[model samples]
Target: MAARRRRDNVLVAVLAVLAVLGGGRTILGWFSTPPPGPSDDTTTKIVGRSQLAESFARDFVVTYLSASANQQDKIAEYVSSGQQVTLPSTGRQVSDPAVVFAEREVSNPQLEVWSVTISAKVGKGAGTAVGTSSSAAASTASSSGTTTSASNASATAGPGRQYYRVAVSVAAGRVRALSLPAAVDAPGRGSDLALANQNSCSPDTPFGQVVSGFLTAYLTGSGDLSRYTVPNSGMVAPAPAPFVSVETATVSTDTTGCGTGGGTARVLATVNPKATDGASPTLAYPLTMIFSAGQWQVQRIDPLPPLRNPLTVVVGDATQGPQVQSTPSSVATTSPSSAVQVPPAKQN
Candidate 1:
């Protein structure tokens, strides 16, 4: 009888232990952490620019624009071996070839399309029109390096200059002209940005002095450049500046008026760069001046000018390309030689 009672007790203990383990497991399930949700970050890729495609298109356009009758061989240098270009009966004078627009083909990953623009000067004689761009020759004149070759369109386009856009395709190191250049409209004009001539003061104003000084030093090599720009702006100009003199056209201010103290101001001005007599480039720049420390100083010389119409400039085409008097190796640099006179900011 004792043996039977012990066997029953053992079975009862085993059942109780199993029940305690099951209950503990159920409680633990309630406290367990839920799985983490999906991540929020989704990486997006950026496309890199291809300078080769742009450069090849630019060179091909210049040659294509200036080609005369039966010059298909010249164009074949840029196009595929079997391709031929319709040559003009008479050659047109074109200069300052610039790439106005560029984009890669999404459908053909290897190909890129570029809109190469050039300034066409008046032709001496009537020329046979083989290409579409020549269609504008009826009204074509000349441009001062007009993109106006100087970054800013000169109010005066000498020799009846007209702007031309050529669509070019580039792939694997070769450029292709699938179509002749088309004469398109000049870029639409934006809002005017002229300085308020509110006060009678012209050259004597403090701000005027600062701007004039900056330009004089930058273009004409007249004053010390260090006096006009902010410290640590890595702007550098080649020695023996590009022009003989500079004159500010219109000085404008942002929120603050030019007469009273203001934070920033833009000059709708033209400081003509009188390039040495090869082809006179249009001398103009879109520049801003800021008031810092006790006086006004030029804000900065952008590596690339703003896409909007550059501030108008009126520099007298007085001087030629100056001999690089000194090499400025210490700072970054850009020489505004084509129809514009934007000097990179000077660094100490």
Candidate 2:
């Protein structure tokens, strides 16, 4: 009888332990859920892409019209990575997410549909984060580059509506190709401002009074800019940066029944203002004008187009095709000795 009792006690203790372990396992199972899914970040390897390039372009256009200088800088980062962007409109690799949010304020402008192509050049250690430090490493490593060309519809709907496309090209994981503003064309011609002005101001309107009225309306943003644009609002020449004095003005003369579309004598407005660029007062800059609807309207002003240099091509291979030394056959060349040939070379 003693032996049997001992055996029973041992069996009971073993059963209890088993019961505890089973219960613990049950509880753990009830509380635990499956492991969380993998994250969305996929770009880990180096590669070239077209879609990523489109995203960069879309972001750039949005940044161009931004009023806040700071917001613009954040958007600039994707293009240039090193510069310390101080102005809201200048910077690189910005961190602010809310900066690009205000693009909803302005309506997307009417944009033409065009093709955009991007080529990718990715070397090992060639990211903006370490570009300055490891530039040589990136340049020396066996570089893999790809060129991706794609066609996308770039449209601006009316004054503020713009559409963009995003594409992706992958080699290993990183984006290495991109294109921008590949093509541009207006779907339709904009309304003619000259025709629209015929229904508005007139030659009888005094030039000074008109200028003053326009200035006041623009500074306050009160008048309808859709009808008339102001240089102060960044719409016209003579950007309203350095304020100048108005020296004199001449009323416009209307010439009716001379030509079709109601021709009018081109008016003239002369003003001698102090130069912000250190030009002399005797310069007497003459602003070309047109008299329409009995008012003198500015047509053109003095200022050359912004300077742009020709692109420099660096040949990568000596085994490539021979360089052509001959000029294009289409170019008509006369004797270089002529006294400064005028543009078009007085065709025939």
Clashes within 3 Å, all models in order: 28, 32
- Clash count, predicted structure 1: 28
Tell me how candidate 1 scores on lDDT.
Answer: 0.52
Model 2 C-alpha lDDT per residue in residues 102-148, reported as the tens digit of each score: 11111113311223322221222212212121222222222332111
Error (Å) of candidate 1 at residue 62 is: 9.3
Estimate candidate 2's alpha-carbon lDDT, on a 0 to 1 scale: 0.31
lDDT of residue 142 for candidate 2: 21
The TM-scores, one per candidate, come to: 0.42, 0.19
lDDT of each: 0.52, 0.31
Candidate 1 residue 186 Cα shift, in angstroms, is: 8.6
User: Which parts of model 2 have CA positions greater than 4 angstroms off?
Assistant: 1-194, 199-208, 213-241, 246-274, 278-348
Which predicted model would earn the best lDDT?
A: 1
Candidate with maximal TM-score: 1
Cα-based RMSD of the predictions, in order? 17.1, 25.5
